[model samples]
Target: MSGARAIVEALEREKVEYIFGMPGGATLPFYDALWDSKVKHVLVRHEQLGAHMADAYGRVARRAGVCTGTSGPGATNLVTGIATAFADSSPVVAITGQVAKAMTGRNGFQETDVVGVLTPVTKYTVQPLSAAEIPSAIRKGFYIAETGRPGPVLIDIPKDVQQEEVEMTFPESIQIRGYSPNYPVDVQDIERAADMLARAERPVLFGGGGIRIADAASQFTAIAELLMAPVITTLQGKGTFPEDHPLSLGPIGMHGRAEANRIVQECDLLLAVGVRFSDRSTGNFHEFAPEAKIIHVDTDPTEFNKNKLVDLSVLGDANRALTLLYDALLRRLAKRDENNAWLKHVNQVREELKGIPAYRDSYAELSGPKIVKLMRSILPPEAILTTGVGRHQMWCEIHYKVLRPRTWITSTGLGTMGFGLPAAIGAKLAAPNVPVVDFDGDGSFVMTEQALATAVEERIPVVSIIINDRSLGMVEQWQRLMYNRRFVGIRFQNIPDFVKLAQAYGVQGRLVGSLQEFGDALREGIRSDQPSVVEVPVSHEEDVFPFMPPGKGIKDTVYGTSKEMAVF
Candidate 1:
């Protein structure tokens, strides 16, 4: 078989049904082979979007997201998406077409040292030296991405390599030096951790995107249920705990829920599983959970004891570590200090949390959380939702009833501005039977709204709910709350009507003024067989509660509906 055909066959053997990418000169042979292959090639408007789709699809399906790009600008554009996936530990396989081997490193046309460019962001990166290595390279990429701490991996295929004929034999197994996916934590360590938790009066469960990546929400739920503790999911960790559950403190961080961040701060013991403590989640590190004894469990050793000093650093799969911990805890007698007082106090604090940012009745137009709740009610349980960065994303994080893991996919680590729409397109394609919706801020969408055409051409139906506030609402909120009404370069002035924007892409678009209109528009978008946009114009005055100012702790948040209004 030809090298190109062999590549396609390898992809097929790896169970890759879709490839998100752009055509490039060096990649002509691969595209030609893909022309008749069973694997569908989704031509994205930008290579960046292709990467985003791959990342989103990987997260949603719990498999590797496959994306391709050309040598120079195409490969460069894919960096952010790759970084996002890498940061969140999502499994993605990035295939790039490099210049011919003979022309490498001599300023070859469209050659940009893809391996070097992608190294920092990928778990592994390689440019195959020969056609015979292509199959192995592909297999290694998939294996590295899905096992242990999943992350993006890159394979750069030289133009000459793609043209060389080669035999195709899938690898029976894969091995990488200095890479181990499984870590068995010591039994004594588990017992010691259990003892610490059993002794603590204020214990909290904190989680991150790794929870979803591991597909271990049930294990997390088991721990919480057994301990009767509230959960504070990181922004990336949203949906690990049902947002509406009594123990759920929607996502704690810079813009976390009041009760959640507060509880995390007040806790005596915090068992953070598969969660890297990002600065955004912890806010100012100095003030972060000063009193909590943090037990950190992660697959990556680099993450161990890297952030807050860990009282216990268990190196293993998050699900497995959690399972061990729960089993050990269950085997031991229940702690005598089990009081529902703290739990009840936390629940009451959630109910009466001051500063629950509600808009003035004069501007009765729905706000972010309000719109998110309405949108959630309209979506099916199976329907997946994607998001871009900004206030809208935070609102959805707080209120969206993400019932299960992988239901929410967004750029949590990189905080990329233009990730939502493409991710929705990717999510929709990966699961064509389910409806995919992307709630984007006007500011965030305008950054990569060009992908709408890709969504249209691909027939990937994504309900894009544009929260049009006419400004970067998050920055504006910060300006209002912290900067003393000094709204600087944070406003989006004179934006186009998103409905008409969708129409120009030959896709459907609608605008909503009130709750009734919002419901009707979302209903139509979800039911529509084609791509559509629902522009829900939200009030600029809207704010997400439990906001920790810069240089403040997670506990230093302002509640949405605070009576005193100053203290979090």
Candidate 2:
């Protein structure tokens, strides 16, 4: 069999349903092999979009999503998407075509050291020297990508190698020296953690992306309820626990809920599970959860004490660790403490914070928060929601309710703009029966608007709710608060109407001016058989509040634009 055929066979063995990419000179043989394979190929308009699609697929399916690109520019274009996956710990397998092995160092046309370029953003990168190495390389790539701290893995195959013939035999199991995904949780660690929780007067359960990545949402919820603790999620951890639950405090960090920030700060113990304690989450490291004794649990040992020092650290998969901890806590406790003063105090704070004035938009008709609330009301609880990074994304985070895990996807760690549209398409493909929507800003949408072409061509019917603010909203907000509102290139002259652009790509388009019109458009898009875009124009002056200025602690949160904007 040819090496390219062997690669397809390996993908089949791994049960890869789809491979997203566009063909280039070096990838012809691979594409030719793919023609006869069961693995569906999604031809993206750009390599970056393909990478983002693959990333979202991995997030939704809980497996290694595959993407391919040719040498040089094709591979480089995938960098941002691959980095986004790495930052958020999404499992993705990226295959790029390389020049013939002989021309590697001579800088042949379209040749690039993709392995060197992608090493930092991938868990592993391999270049099969010969056709015989293809099968094992692919198996290891998938294993590394989907195991431990799930991340992207790259496979760079030379054109000559792809054309070479070999007798392929795929290995069922692989063992890489100095690499292990499994970590057994110590009984003593669980017991110690349980004891700490039991003795604490006030405790907060902090969950991150790892919970969803490990499929441990149920275990996380069990532990939270067992302890009668307040649950605060990081941005990446959204939807891991039901937002409507009484114990849920929503997301915490810079744009976190005011009540959540207050509660976390006051808590005596913070049980941080599968979280990295990034700077965005911990405003000023010294001031964050200052009074709390934090117990950090993660599979990656390197993450231990990398950000904030913890009282105890447990190294194990999130599901296994959380399961054991829940069992230990259950065995140790007799009954729920209905009269716990800490719980009552937390509830009181939550209610008190509710009385804080809601952000009043100058243009109430097209308010971001109100629009997001309307979306929540219209979309089913199980619908998958994706967002582009900007003021709009933050608004969705604040107002949109995600009831289940894997239903909410976004570029949290990397904060990549233009991620929503392609991600929504990828998510829709991953879950064909589930409804998918992208809450995108105009600036972000324009960056990857070409994706609508792919959606139309592929017959992926996802709704894109473009929050057309006519500016780079987030950057403009920062300029207003920190740079004296002297905006430079933030605003955009309304050229190329989004509704028309959507129509140009053969997608259903709707221009909504009022809230009712917006609702009607959204519902229409959701019910449509083809890809649709609902363009919602809003004021550029609109800003996402409950803002934590850089270098400030959560206690210094700005609840609205009415509050004094701190110049950091």
Best by lDDT: 2
Q: Model-by-model lDDT, in order? A: 0.84, 0.90
TM per candidate comes to: 0.94, 0.98
lDDT of 1 at 167: 69
Model 1 lowest lDDT segment of ten: 354-363
| Cα lDDT tens digits for candidate 1, 236-316 | 888888877777877888777667777787888998887888888888766777888988878788997677787888777
Off by over 4 Å in 2: 359-363, 563-568
Which residue pairs in candidate 1 have backbone atoms (N, alpha carbon, C) closer than 3 angstroms, thus clashing? 354-561, 354-562, 355-559, 355-560, 355-561, 355-562, 356-559, 356-560, 356-561, 357-560
Error of 1 at 546 (Å): 2.7
Tens-digit per-residue lDDT, 1-568, candidate 2: 8889989999999999999999999999999999889999998999999999999999999899999999999999999999999999999999999999888899889988999999998999999989999999999999999999999999999999999998888999988997898988887988899899888889999999889988899999988887888999998898989999989999888888878888999999999988999888888899999999999889999999998999999889989988998888878885466468988999999888775544343446887898998899999989999999999999887778789999999999999999999999999999999889999999889889999999999999999998988889999999998999899998887557887898899988898989999999888888888999998888888788788888799878888775534321
RMSD of each: 2.4, 1.8
Best by TM-score: 2
State the TM-score for model 1.
0.94
